[model samples]
Target chain A: MVNHSKKSINQYAGYIYLLPGLAWIFFVFAIPIIQLIGMSIRQGPVGQEILGFDNFIFTFRDPLFIKAITNNIKLLVIVPILIILSLIFSTFLYERIKGWQIYQTIIFIPVILAVAAMGIVFSQILQLKGLLNETLRVLRLNFLIQDWLGNQGLALGSVVGVIVWKELGFGTILFLARLMSVDKELYEAARIDGASGFQLMIHITIPQLIHIIEFYAVLLIVTAFSFVFDYILILTNGGPNNQTIVGEFFVYKYGFIYNRFNIASSVAIVYLLVGIVLMILRYQIVKRIDS
Target chain B: MKKIALSRIMKQIIMITMVVIALVPIYYVFVTMFKSPDEYLFNKWGLPLELSLENFKRLMEGETIFRWLINSLIISGFSVLISILVASMMGFAIARFDFPGKSALFVAVTSLLVLSPAVLVIPLFKSMVKLGLINTYYSAIIIYTGIMLPISTYLLTNFFKSIHNDIIDAALIDGCSLFQIYYRIMIPLSMPAIVTAALTNWLYVWNEILIGLIFLQSDKMRTLMPGLSLFKGKYTTNIPLTMAGVAVAIIPTFVIYLMGQRYFVKGLTEGAVK
Candidate 1:
């Protein structure tokens, strides 16, 4: 009975120890999210307002808002495909082949570089007078060369390509790590049962990676909105007439550059809502998968 | 023998192709950084026409590159240090002690794993302004600590839980205080996770652009990412100089990872496995 009481007291002390971290998160994170939602509903000017839903109404009615949503949707589609490709690449490299470490190191280099640097390098490569165009011209394939980052239709795609190049390394590393943890006995058993290479991957490896895939999918989507700053700012500046405008960039432009705080706040609220919903969905999916 | 030779050849080919594709842009950056404006334009994809240090000279002479580099190091270093210290403590308490609201706290921190900092930027900015922390290094460090703490804590908690409780109990019985056990026993035992968390958070803080751009307006206070943008503006057409700036920013992280590759790989895979 005395030992049980001591155990309970220690457990209670554990909760006390957690207070500082809890308080820090609540102040720095949770409160701000609440503030964003509150500010979105309240409105006056850049620093003053108490109007309700007007900001949301104004933001939704704006044409750029629609464009940002659509562009984000396009990214949502493109990034997952790239992630799948990365998974395929990771699996190929995970075969305990010779020089696998060297491959992993090389692939991960791009992930270490700053995004601003990537933007500048990719911009130069995709320039009208850039190396990519030069290569195409040399190959007598000038038709394949267009102003990759200049054309409105292709600008977002160009940014997406750079993003894929930059991110594929990290994704490959992550998936490869997860893949290594999977028991090799499963693969050997499948082989003993006469399963082919393709069949083993489809039947054993892919299903096992489903939880990780879902986790990474949600991570990529959230990052797609938050982390595209370097791409937008450096590559196109959300331009050739807002063709590459994403919601996060929209918030930045309005809030920082144009001083449209009310509208930016509303947009942020919308973004937060979308992020929360997607995350909850991912959580549910992962929970179901785990069980 | 023929099949073995073929397999060896196949592996070489695939590895080489992947390496070349990966290294092309990096090579482009390094090669251009050593070339003059004329060479950069003429031999855009080739070796430098004539080796020159003019771009690097100009970059150093004209800009606050060194200052930004120092600022980035300070911010990343301090932010990562504080985050690890605080996160490890929180993690230890949660893992070792069965406490009320432990599950709730765990869920709260874990949920933050999915919360994007982008969505929080505006409100955070407002909060910073209200706190009179705008345009200050303190703001950046504080915000970074907050952002990183949750995930690091979560990772460390997972790591700490994996450690045998019997060892901790032994230490306690042997007259080690709670803090002593945490510092001497728990932390040393969990070094791999701690190192990995520190490295990951360091990279995030170093490569971070969004918060730095918003919170830091002065040229001297700007980190590498924002500073690199200024390099772009000045050398708008000069690929080589821009690449040099990029090279400078990338080398430290690369070297660090290489030096600690064994621990880095082990930590990442171990932490991620669960």
Candidate 2:
């Protein structure tokens, strides 16, 4: 009876510790999110009454909305490219390539810098007569020079290029770290079986790092969907003519710029749903890894 | 042996090219910041005829960069501290206790770990407006704390669980209250994790432009990122000046990253890897 009472008391005390943080999350995150759902389903300035799914219907028909989703989907191509580049670079570093130490440090620099700031820098570099074009000219590759961020047809591609450049370092370092932690015995065992370098990586390194790769892929997907806002907002402002407008930018434009909060809320709801699905997938992966 | 040596050389060449690609823009920014505007137009990829601090001077004198920097410092600093404190407390509760609904709460928080708060911007904006926190430091700080809590708490909880329970039991037997055990034992023991969480939150809040841009709408209230971004628009013609602003904005993160590279790497990979 005495032990039982002490255990019960401990259970209640836990709530005290959880209270302040939960309260902040409740008020600041939860309440606002609830409002988001409410606003998504309503109409007009007052944001009262059920308007059914009209806002969502309009959003579906909106061409800009389609453009935004398409642009985000288009950005998905970066994930594979990122993974491949990271694997290659990390493998090189793992083999202790020349100057690997300096290379590792320099690469991660971009990952830590502000996306908005780097976006601005890239904006200048991608301009019609900017440093990139100048460098191309100097190298006698003037044929490759174009308005990297200006031409609507090429603007999104330019944005992708910039994202790749900035993000490559993160994956490389992450993979390298994981690779370092991997058992050297595994590789040695493979080598004794007459496995070539490529074969060793294909069978052993890839399998050993599969879980982190999956986690990173999901992260990159979430990033493509939402985190590219800074890049888009800075690099193109979704422009030359809305060619690079993405889901997050769509929400921001409709909500803040256009004052179409209902439509914005609807778009946000759609994105939120997609994000929740990904998060659930990620949660399961993390749970499996943890267990 | 010859083939292996050749492949090694090929790998070295590719990596060197990648390193150059990575460093060029940063190099260009630093180089441009030291050049005169006219010098930048004429010498886009070369050293200036003579180095000039004029652009930096103009950025400092002509804009509110310092004010924005200070605002960013206050917002990120306070938000990181408060979130860490709140997260450590919550982590302790979750790690040390066995209450009903505990698993549910942990799942919810973990699910949110991968969910960026960008989608919540619209409703969050309305809430901020309703609360009349639209232009204050509290606006960004509060939202940032909430945004960071799930991950912070998650990291701390995992760390707290690693700490042996004997320590806690001893504290309990010695009559140290629950809160006393937390503050006296848990806090001191979890400094590395707390620092990791703090650095992660600081990086997010500092680099965050969307929430800060929307929440802190006024000119004097803007954080460094939004300020620098908007400044980029108005001053597009002056490449050197824009580069100067970029250089200044990148400095704090660069300094912190250099100082705590290990912590930064640890914090980021801790989430994805075991």
Candidate 3:
């Protein structure tokens, strides 16, 4: 009984200690989400009188909204493909192979550089007069040279490729770390049992990586949604006629550029909901797999 | 013996090809930084036949790149320092003390890990405006602190939990105050994790552009990312000079990462594992 009382007292004190962090979150995160939802429901210009649901309706009806949603869906599709590629690369590198560290370091260098720097470098590299086209010309494949970033269809793909190159190393490193942690005995046992390398990987290594995979999947989803700033903004600015505008860029444009706070808030709220759902789905998947 | 040697050579060739593909762009940027505009346009990938410091000199002397660099340093430095201090204190408190609602607080803090800055930019802008902090260094610093605190605290909390309670108890028995124990013992014990967190946070703050772009409007306050955009207008087609700017921006972080590779790798892998 005395121990229980002490535990209760400690629990109370824990709440008190937690007050600052909790309050900050409530103010910064919870309250902003609430305000976003509120703003979404109300229609007005910046600092104007609230008109119910008008801004949301405007946002929903806007052609750019659909474009943004479709672009985001495309990104969602593309990101997982890169993640799979990273997994394969990571597994290959994790074999304690010669020069593994050098490869790892080289691959990860792009990630260490700022995305803004990446955008500048890639833009120059892919420009019409840039190295890529110049290389084609030098090879006497002049007919093959084209304006890579200028083409509407090609521009989005180019940006996505940059995103993959920028992100893959980090993902590979993450998976490699997890792979290293898996007990070598499992691999050795499988090998002793006459399991092939592929079979061992499928049955043992992949299964062991389920948790880390889910964690990274959630992270990738969040990053895909929020972190395409330099590529999209710099490469295309959601253009070749708004063909590459993701939701976050849309929100930024609406809020800051168009000064449509209501619409921006609505988009933000929708993004928040989508993010929460994705996270919850990931959690459920992980839980089910763990169980 | 010939067959085995041939296979080894083939593997080396493949590895070299992969390394070349990865390093080409990095090399391209670095080489271009030292080349004249004519050399850059004519031989985009070649080693500079006549190396020049003119691009670097021009960037430093003409453009506001230096100012932007200083601004980035100040904002990222202060923000990282404040984050470490606040996060360590909170992490130590949670790890050592048996307190109320601890689990709930932990959950709340960790949940912020899922919340991205893109979602918070507008609302944060509003808050900053209301607080009269727009276009101020304080706005950038506070936002960085607020957003970063949760993750840093989570990392440090995990680190603190790994430490044995016996040492802390002994310190308490010796009549050491909580702050002293934290400063003298916990901090030293968790130095690796602390350093890792600091370095990670520093890289993040240094690289972050979206928030910096929105919160800071003044030419003087603009960071490397936004400030570099100005060069695009002036140079218009000068890829080499722009590449120079990129090289300059990346070198500091690269050096820092190289210096702290062990802590960085350990911290990243260990934090994720936990």
Candidate 2, residue B25: Cα displacement in angstroms equals 1.1
Best by DockQ: 2
Candidates 1 and 3, the one with greater TM-score: 1
Candidates, DockQ: 0.54, 0.68, 0.45
True contacts kept of 2: 0.74
Q: Model 2, range B45-158, lDDT digits (tens) per residue?
A: 787777778987887796688889999999999999999999999999999888889988977875676665667888788877888989999889988998899889888989
lDDT for B8 in candidate 2 is 87
The residue-by-residue lDDT of candidate 2 on A28-146, one tens digit each, is: 66776788887777674335565778777778888999999999999998999999999999998998998999999988888888988888989888888777888899899989999
Locate the minimum summed-lDDT window of 10 residues in model 3 chain A.
A1-10
lDDT of 3 by residue, B1-274 (tens): 6965675566567666757766778888888888888887678788988778888998889658898999999999999887888788778768876755776666567667666577888888898889998888999888887778777887899899989878877886687756687889999999888898888788888888878888998887888876765556567678778888988888998898889876666555556446
lDDT of 1 at A215: 66
Which has the greatest TM-score?
2
TM-score of each: 0.92, 0.97, 0.91
Docking class of 1: medium
lDDT of 1 by residue, B1-274 (tens): 6966786687677667767767888888878888877776567778886678887788789668888898899999999998888788789888888756777777668667666676788888988899998878899998999899877897899889889878877776787767787889999999888888998888888888878889998877888888887678777876677888888888887898888775655544445435
lDDT of 2 at A289: 72
Total clashes for model 3: 7
